[model samples]
Target chain A: MHEHQEPTPETFSTPVLSTTTATATAVAAEAAVPGAMLATPANESTTAQSLSTASQEPRQGEPTAQSNEIQLTDEQILTQMQAIKDEEANAHPLVDNSVDLTELEKEYENGSQAFKNKIKNLSDTHDRMRRSRGDGNCFYRAIAFAWFERVMLAKTKPELYTHAIKAMEESKDLLLAAEFEPLAFEDFYAVTLETLESVPTSTPEALLTAFQTDEISNSIVMHFRLVASAYLKTHQEDYAPFLEFGQTMDEYCSMHVEAMGRESEEMMLIALTKAMHIGIEVAYLSGNQSADEVNFLPFSPDTEPYMPPLVLLYRPGHYDILYRKSHCLEGVV
Target chain B: MAKPMFARRLSKELKDLAMNPPAGVDIIDANDFKVWKLGLAGAPGTLYEGEKFQLEFNFGPNYPLESPQVLFVGDNVPIHPHIYSNGHICLDVLYNHWSPVQTVASICLSLQSMLSSCTSKERPPDNANYIKTARANPKHTAWAFHDDTV
Candidate 1:
């Protein structure tokens, strides 16, 4: 018999869509059946279901494409339910103590239209809860990509699938920077599958090209893959799942390491050339030096003509090849 | 030149702070470049009245672009449910809502205001068990910040 009142000013800005849906689903599910899925589902299950439902519903006032590409994987959906069940059993504390949820469930079932109103009233309160938990536009994007991944995988649309992958590649920085890591994986998986769909069936070149341009993140990734590939070649028996999630980062790291190894002698010559060229104080060199630091000197066009010693060093065979190639790939550096 | 870029910007920010420090706040560590510590006074007419709290601010190489890891220091930790015993705040702005514009002063002020307006001196009901055991990992534990009846 608590009277309805507007939420306080402090909590007006919390992200509510996921909270409302999650709460409504929980209450609705409870109203429909009590003690359901009680065999100890994991915490990830609730987040997955919340994420899946988010994918289905369009944002208010904005019409989302009926993207069949996005659907929650069976594993993801199950994870959501299990997580909710765990939360209910283990973390029994709720912010509102006025009406007990267990009591409210019975009250809601027994012709309490007021209960529905209560649900609606508390919607705003939960919205802030969601926002505070790091749900935002990025979260929505993850859900959307998750949906896209499921639907496209289900139907096999190469174009939309590839587009989705590219979308993920573009949005990776956004996904990575988020505090919520679980959703990031789902989004990343969707994009990877989508990007895989876009690759032409016959050519690894097409795959390499896609990785080079639109999927430059994949370049860093490819470096990791190259490293892993090399590792596998050397230590095939001891393969680890750590780098199995995706090849992009592993590949990128491996390639950079390989490149530095190959260019070390040239790098030293370049550092010597730069010291002679610019005459810029080569102040003590106190810290741990990296290959990229020395690599910068000989290849830098601005510093090249200034040093006659550098020009002489650069006039050689490998140095000439390295300089020409470096200049060509100037933007990348 | 790269050193000057950071040095100049930091100096400018320091000068700006000297001219107009946030209300009842003090910026310390003008000499050391690594550690930036600021002091906060609890806001009046609230639970945290007349208390002085200090916050430690650490800046990484990516200044402004990356948010500072701010933590409440010393004994007067605000007894909020969301705050960790180790003084790590669970506020979204300190991590996710963190904009580049928010200075050490502004963050200290926000925390001060958040403390001053508190009607309850208790932690969230789940805080005792959750905070006790949840120290294992902050990232994995999903804190339900949804208390409406407060």
Candidate 2:
């Protein structure tokens, strides 16, 4: 019943941004993992003067305990921190196999009673859930992985795979109709189509490997981002009203959808689903809901959805793949 | 894997820049995909008209996905409210607002417009301090883009 539904923002992408959620995320990230993150731009109002002055503040409390770390420039430190965050997320593959729901329960162990109750209730029907990395693109990555997995299992239901390919193929036209240059977007489109075509013949391990690589995984993310942006741009009448005041749909899509590390919002989900003719069921696991109940929100395409909606577990600013009890594709996974 | 993407994208951009180059943009060097140098002409009717500025574009493997490291290069950097003496630009699109859809041509055009709209001939107020303390790479600088009506 609480009104706030936006995802909790995560680590700063590069330079620290001015958004309140981003600032909170940066502070939490610095505290959670100690390193050069200590030197991050503390706020959006940091003038060029403060940057130089901050450097002279005598960086203390950062003696490298793990290794004989030599000196590193602030740029190098930021780069290393980025690598560490990547490694932590890479601890799980771009997509991971069904983990016992207890594993998720462990994350909130000292955290929340309401979340604990929902997880306890969730395990009854959803015995196992797969996960995607917590990188900002997790929502798009999860939806892509989940839909592709379903299409792979639909060997008997050839229509699903065929439909997915059609949707992907038509998305290029959407980008073009929205006036996105072919030269700018063609590479992402080609990589995405190649990955989708490989899913059917590829084993689950092979699929996981493909998604693990940066080129393939990020290209898919980029393509979907473009598709969502294109969908919003071409169908402005339907979505323009939803944008914030003084912000045009083009600006919203540019900032939120096209940028790689930017998080996706509800409008993005609706646009992506409607654009690709896919349905999505997002299980909102929140502390605000009744202790024992999880809310499922549906995002459906304008027409009849061709396949069962791909399900995702949403836990504030992050998305991970979830498996229903009846799903029988363990061998593939 | 990303190298090929950079090659194809950069090559196409080079071809576009060569064939139908935007007004006042000219390529000085682009033999390789990694680094390119292009000349940006300050637009007519601006403070820098008839003045030529050299721009250096360093492309990482992440090229269109990640933005290129672009700055004023060579001897003559433009004197403007957003341009620092060390060549770092305080433009938002170059950093926080980067989108893959933007091209090298588009960037040059944006810079051209940025220069064309200049109302005064001056450097950023922080130019002296910034050039003294900033790193070689502009991306490393935590730029605050607050002013737009320069």
Candidate that would win on lDDT: 2
TM-score of each: 0.31, 0.82
What's the lDDT of the predicted structure labeled candidate 1?
Answer: 0.36
lDDT of 1 by residue, A1-333 (tens): 011111111111112234334444433432221112111112223333342321111111222223343444434543654554344323321111122223323434533354545433433222111111111111212122222223233333444444435444533433343221322133223435445555434243443333323122222222222222333333323333323454443232223222211111222222222221221111010011221121122233234332111111110011111111232233210
The window of 10 residues in a row where model 1 chain A has the poorest summed lDDT is A313-322
Give i-RMS (Å) per prediction. 17.7, 12.1
Give the DockQ-based CAPRI class for model 1.
Answer: incorrect
lDDT of 2 at A309: 77
lDDT of each: 0.36, 0.72
What TM-score does prediction 2 earn?
0.82
Over the full model, what C-alpha lDDT does candidate 2 score relative to the true structure?
A: 0.72
**Highest DockQ against the true fold, candidate:** 2
Poorly placed runs, candidate 2 (over 4 Å)? A1-75, A78-82, A109-113, A327-333, B1-3
- Angstrom error of the Cα, residue A148, model 2: value is 1.1
- lDDT digits (tens) for residues A129-228 of candidate 2: 7877655677888988887778877777777788889998899899999999898999889988998898778887777777787778888889999999
Best TM-score among the predictions, by candidate number: 2
Listed models, DockQ each: 0.01, 0.39
